[model samples]
Target: MSFEHEKQVCNLFHNSMEIIGRRWTGAILVSLMDGPKRFNEFHNMIPEISSRLLTERLKEIEDYGLVTRTVLSDRPIQVIYALTEKGAELQPILQLIGNWAARWDSKPNIEENTTEKVLNI
Candidate 1:
């Protein structure tokens, strides 16, 4: 490929990595791959993340036009978050990554290891 085409590809990959590489961002996006979710649902899906961090990541993704936030007019005023078309496009890519991890990741049980270490069990 020409140098200019290579540069453009590099830039596109970098920008995508910048968004997905943020802590908890990938997990958040993966959680939403099934459908829309409420704030608490995210917490349930990714229990390791704090509430404030989840809020921040959600706002950041929303700003990037990857997610759409809608406030429901219910009595308690619920808020729902869903992937936009741009974000939905990531589902297959994320699935491919998951497949790769399953096949090659050396520490697939890292979370279990960490928990065992923490509990000294």
Candidate 2:
């Protein structure tokens, strides 16, 4: 491959990692795969994350065009966060990562989680 091609590939890879490699970012993305969620719903999905941090991460992805924040008009305005097409594209990537980790990651207690329980079959 040409040097220019290699350089572009490397740049793309690092850029992708910089966004997705942030702590809790991948988990947050994974949590959104099923459908839209509210702020509290995200917190429930990732209980370890602080509300402030979750807000920050959501804003970051939204800026990246990966997530969309929609405010609904109601008695009390409700805000919903959903993955954009770009964000939805991460689902398969996450699944591949999970499959790889399941094979090689050394966390034996992983099976204690609910997903592992269901995946055990």
Question: What is the alpha-carbon lDDT of model 2 when measured against the actual structure?
Answer: 0.83
Which candidate number would show the highest lDDT if scored against the true structure? 1
Task: Write out the backbone clash pairs for model 1.
Answer: none
**lDDT, residue 69, candidate 1:** 100
Q: Give Cα distance to truth, residue 50, candidate 1, Å.
A: 0.5
After superposing candidate 2 on the true structure, give the runs of residues whose Cα lies further than 4 Å from its correct spot.
112-121
Give the per-residue lDDT digits (tens) of candidate 1, residues 22-90. 999988998888789999999887999999999999999999999999999999999999999999998
Which RMSD does model 1 reach against the true structure? Answer: 6.1
Question: Candidate 1: where is the Cα deviation over 4 Å?
Answer: 108-121
